[model samples]
Target: MDSTRKYTAEAPPLQEVQQTRGPLVLEFGTSWCGHCRAAQPYINEAFTSGPDLPHHKIEDGKGRPLGRAFRVKQWPTLIFLRDGEEVERLVRPADSASITRAMARIEQN
Candidate 1:
């Protein structure tokens, strides 16, 4: 797990993301989004004790192909993927339990 958490504006292409192996989490949101900001604590807490998987905080907005490819409509959408296929998802998570639960699902696979 990454100790430094921040959303990166430049994200990999949709095709490249789909080709990833093993479990990973994709978090989509802008830096200034309130809902995205509010969810950070929960996200952080989950990662703190959760499995050491690749977690990417991608800055998403207009013209972002990766977000659109995943059909993300809400900020801070956490997509749990195993072998590049989605297993579970959490949107605007309010608690670490929910995020942990979602991570568990993918970790199980």
Candidate 2:
């Protein structure tokens, strides 16, 4: 899958993602969000290092099922998972290091 691709529809069930093999990154935010846009470069840089990692960019807003399930309260929330289990999360990461650190958690698992 395209690491930079953004999903506009509702995200898959958290349980489904959790059950999926390998590492995954669930990114919650809207395309129009300034915070999300600002963090794109860092996010890209981190994920680019692991081209095989699945990065799901889900558009989040009020009443969105997946976002609600994850209890997302901020824009650009990155949830790292391995074997469908949450490994780490970063909200509004300030730099590539922060994103890289989160990605490392998944790699280490």
Candidate 3:
């Protein structure tokens, strides 16, 4: 997956994406968010280190169903899941290390 990719305004249902096989990273953020843009490099680096992992950037804002389901209250919320179950979450990560650490959890499971 391309780490620098932009999220769409509409996304596949959260439950549907969760049902997908293997490890998945669901990133909730808006394109106009500064925090989201700032974290892009770190997010990209983490994904670069784990290329096989599936990463979905879902545009999130007020009333977005997926974000609401996850109870997202901030930009750049990265939810890590394994086998359709949430394993970890990082909100507005300050560095690549944080993201890498989260990825490690997914890798271990």
lDDT winner: 1
CA lDDT of every candidate: 0.89, 0.84, 0.88
Residue-level lDDT of model 1, residues 1-109, one tens digit each, is 8724689988988777889988989999988999998988888888998888898889999888899999999998999999999999889899999999888888888
Give the alpha carbon lDDT tens digit for every residue of 1-109 in model 3. 7888788887789779778777889999989999999999999988888646878899998889989999999989999988888999999999999888888788678
- Model 1 pairs in collision: none
Query: After superposition on all CA atoms, what RMSD does each candidate show versus the true structure?
Result: 1.1, 1.6, 1.2
Q: How many collisions per candidate?
A: 0, 1, 0
Which one wins by lDDT: 1 or 2? 1
| lDDT: worst 10-residue window of model 2 | 1-10
Q: Could you give the candidate ranking by lDDT, starting with the highest?
A: 1, 3, 2
What's model 1's lDDT at 63? 87
lDDT of 3: 0.88
Clashes of 1: 0
TM per model?
0.94, 0.89, 0.92
The segments of candidate 2 whose C-alpha lies over 4 angstroms from its true place after superposition are none
lDDT of 1: 0.89
Q: Pairing residues by index, what is the TM-score of model 3?
A: 0.92
